[model samples]
Target: MGDAATPLADTRRWLERAVIGLNLCPFAKSVHVKGQVHYALSEAQDAQEVLEDFTRELEALVALPAPERDTTLLVIPRGMEDFLGFNDLVARAERIVRKRRLEGVIQVASFHPRFVFAGEAEDDVTNYSNRAPYPTLHLLREESMDRAVAAFPDAAAIYEVNMETLRRLGLEGWTALDVGPHA
Candidate 1:
């Protein structure tokens, strides 16, 4: 197994440079600042293994108080590297959450080095917002998420704003961030 430090470093950089620096997720900065995000590495090389890791993480998250750990970014640095395969794992992870009877309490957001939006070109700059150096599953507490969304003004417009933010950055600028697939 690899040192947890390496993955944590990479994940932290991605959160700062891509997610925070790019303003991809507005709520991210606050949670990050409060040290509420848990960065965990999953040494899984297959879909089932990844699912197992997801189950473990979910249980841990729900077992603790929300203030202790508001969210978790389960970093899968190996396996399911392909966007489609990573997406499939995400589906299975969601089902596992539901089967575990933790559906509304927690939810998942997906990130991949090759994440692509439907109908968007493979090289589209906007998709870079969701791209990370590895396949990552963002485990969120639904209650906290709902509260954050409610408190944030004009939450519904976040998507449109993010799209425009990427366009302004352009592919060249995104490449400069050095946290994309190739990085």
Candidate 2:
């Protein structure tokens, strides 16, 4: 497996490239519609601090004027939360969005680590034949992207995955469940 530190960054860069390459023209119209990364807090004490930072950054981003009429806000979550905590956060965010009148603009996405192998053939060729097993890299699902994009109509969502890992998996269109952008 690749070093943890660089993998995430590398994944993010690849995602940026993929989005650009897709040429989803509508998303490109608004300056406010951009990707963001967030890490989950490890402790209750850290929540406030994390929230404060998020709020500040979000406020600043929202304040900026967009050349287009539509704007999309993407929120990426980094940690696990109990059902209660998750509901609470969602409720609070909903309230905040309503209060700010930002519905249909702001989108929240949660990402967890996942292993993606290249399709069976590649795995057989590389991992089976090689002395060492092939590495499984973290990947986000297209379902997660769909959910995020649906929540925020003006936004597009994507999960971060290692390109190398995907190449190894040999996954093709429809193999990964609707690989294209959400309609």
Candidate 3:
């Protein structure tokens, strides 16, 4: 892959620029890449349901794109242990993607509530409801972030592309693309 540092920096820079250009708040979160399972436990019934829905959506995402399937997925769990469902979902996704011989990549991660931001503009965090925009931004654990940087230094740039693509399409941009059907 490209230099790890380059991609990581690119992702971070892209996110930073997007936040500014889109008038989005910082959201106080760090992004990273790694191979691990993350789960969140929540008491809210809605949170639990949304977590399941997120997993299904994630599975379908990885299955899309027929050729040159290089893609990264950011998975946000409902709560701790919610990753259990995520793991199952990933297995199913792997089967589908592999069966189609799609050239893509899938990376799963989770975000803490602290990393989420809500508001109409970038500076405000008022409207921040984790459920609306996305269930989670999925963070790479502290240790994993370090390793991900080591492995894919250029992840930052790649991540920028992801954020830019999202912005261009607008919120729920993936839905507009009909990557599958909206959850």
Candidate 4:
């Protein structure tokens, strides 16, 4: 929203400063450093168009080798401003993966500016773990995820660690990151 490059720039900052800096996802650093992550900007103005964009990104990701493109962040700068609507889009995305019979090969993860855990309060800092500057669909390869999980000694503990990290950081600390659109 800030500019033509705002979405991607802010996303990269969020990934580097929050995701990697906080060690939220232990596996992200490697692919990021190796430049295997793809950043796709969607010009869709509606859910239907967004889904179309999602399908294209999914196909593109699977078409390339893991070493070439391990993952993709389909950034939606228009439409999908509502979290609930974004959730619906995510469901549709999941169905797309299943329909293509790529359910086990690829996965769709959602991240939004207003991401909130089911039971958590909207203002909870922990929700920031999945929040992004704009609505985003994180397409990840199952094989890469499996390899990363296997390489990590305690992959299960990563979630707990992220929770503690965010709790300690608090909203104030999150705002300090300046990765969000408002920030």
Best by TM-score: 4
TM-scores for every candidate against the unseen true structure: 0.94, 0.36, 0.29, 0.97
lDDT of 2 by residue, 91-150 (tens): 554555557665555544322222113454432322211111111111122343455457
TM-score of 2: 0.36
Q: Which stretches of candidate 2 lie over 4 Å from their true place?
A: 1-11, 17-45, 67-91, 114-183
**66, model 2: CA deviation in Å?**
2.1
Model 4 C-alpha lDDT per residue in residues 4-96, reported as the tens digit of each score: 677888889989999998898999999999999999999898999999999999999999999999999999988999999999999999999
Clashing pairs in 4: none
Clashes of each: 0, 6, 36, 0
Residue 156 displacement (Å), model 1: 1.4
Worst 10 residues of 3 by lDDT: 126-135
Which stretches in model 4 have alpha-carbon errors above 4 Å?
none
Q: What are the Cα lDDT values of the candidates? A: 0.87, 0.34, 0.36, 0.93
Residue 16 in candidate 1, Cα distance off native in Å:
0.9
lDDT of 1 by residue, 57-141 (tens): 9999999898889999998888777899888899999998899898999999998889999999999988887887788999999
**Descending-TM-score candidate ranking:** 4, 1, 2, 3
lDDT (10s digit) by residue, model 3, range 14-89: 3334433343322222331222222232222344454455455545544544222222323332243343453454
Better of 3 and 4 by lDDT: 4
